[model samples]
Target chain A: MPKAPAGTLYRGREGMWSWVAHRITGVLVFFFLFAHVLDTALIRVSPTSYDKVIGTYKNPIVNVMEVGLVAAVVYHALNGIRIMLIDFWEKGPRYQKQMLYVELALFVILVVPDAYFSLEHTVRTIFGST
Target chain B: MTATVDGAGRPVIEAPRSRAPRPGRARARSNFELYAWVFMRVSGLALIVLVFGHLFIMNVLDGGVQRINWGFVAGRYASPFWRLWDLTMLLLAELHGTNGLRTVINDYAERPQSRFWLKMMLYTSAFLVVTLGTLVIFTFDPNISG
Candidate 1:
């Protein structure tokens, strides 16, 4: 007999980590976006001040935070898309595991390069290369 | 698009009969509903992967936290590749999430007008974000132009 994976909900369709993660990321992205809007709007106050504020965003730590921000937005968006498709299924409930595999593949394809570009850009700029 | 019957073509959106069917057939067995049911499952499954992979990478990867900035963003967006990557992610997420929410609204909202206006607001918001986000990603200038 196949052994069950740890952290299995013992009762649920698909992964519970995904569901909780989706909801949390959705809320987090929304809140962060609101703050981002406020920060961005600061440009209206004056360019230099705004740029200075924007300068703060250049900090690697802040950039790392953005990785989190982007991740949240990405996850929420992808899962939400997945959920939408499932809702359209003729028999989605029957093929959930297969769908899970598909979604995981899609996720990997999207995030890896996202993180890579983020790092590449940071490294290039820190070393003073375009 | 229109469905053709006999020698005539009729719009699918147009009713076969304006008044609809008898009480027993009001909710006829339908593939329309079946499609929507399937859409939710498929989208849900996609969301699971898109959402979790995003989390693990951002929150759990190298340094486990703390390593980002404008230069980081600028470096990536400087390339057309990252720009496209971002654009795809943005479009997919906005469309998927909003569409998912749209399904929820359709399921819950009873009144036609209520549904219409709610959807109006939701779509409006979604469109605004998609447009603005795309613009920001493409037109982004790290050098600050006045």
Candidate 2:
């Protein structure tokens, strides 16, 4: 058997990178939903359980994690659209790389403001100012 | 999308190689890919609305997370409106993400055994979550015994 190359994951063109990112983000979002549904289901047990669970999410660490979730979600959604276009549009496959660039651009644009707001909220909540 | 053998007896130019399933796997109907492809697009568009609306309602509007409590949840689910909304979002998002992961696994997993097991685990967990979530949404009882 041939030995695998080092940095194999990093060695990819734009489309490959986007494919990797989409898969990673997709997995992250899936796990997030898993946790989210479990937590939300706490409501069925009792409101107290639900509120207490949600209360745990107000800390600094969890708040930062939320920002990361936001980033993952933003990228996944944008790249998902890119994938859709590539599959559906007649001209899409030919310009897959260009579409990836556009997706990345939009990802940065949306995630930056979202991260900012998420952090701002985190700070306020941590300080008990809000 | 035909393959031809070279002078050395190696098959050449398997043009449909990318779309073909791994060896030993049953070939899917050609339209399956097309349907899965279309499902992603349609479900994705639906999720944008359902998910964003959920985020906005839960985290941004009317005093955000602080305002979230049993009462808040009960109030929302008290109406059929929020129940349907949450239910739709839950089902669509789960199915869409699961299908996307299925494609990822099919594309990347080198071993057929690995692919089969991975998808088995995925479908099992997805079923558990979706079922539990749906039941919770529909059968939630606001009153609890002390």
What are the per-model DockQ values? 0.09, 0.38
Residue-level lDDT of model 2, residues A1-130, one tens digit each, is: 1245565656578878887888898889998899999999998887777888998666668867776887888788887778878877999999988888888788798767666655666677567665
Q: Name the best candidate (by TM-score).
A: 2
Error of 2 at A129 (Å): 6.6
Error of 1 at A32 (Å): 6.9
TM per prediction: 0.47, 0.78
| Per-residue lDDT over B2-77 for candidate 1, one digit per residue giving the tens place of the 0 to 100 score | 5544345543454565675676676758787667555545555654555455445434455322343344445655
Best by lDDT: 2
Cα error of candidate 1 at position B22, Å: 6.6
Please give the TM-score that candidate 2 achieves against the real structure.
Answer: 0.78
Model 2 chain B weakest 10-residue run by lDDT: B57-66
Spell out the clash pairs found in candidate 2. none
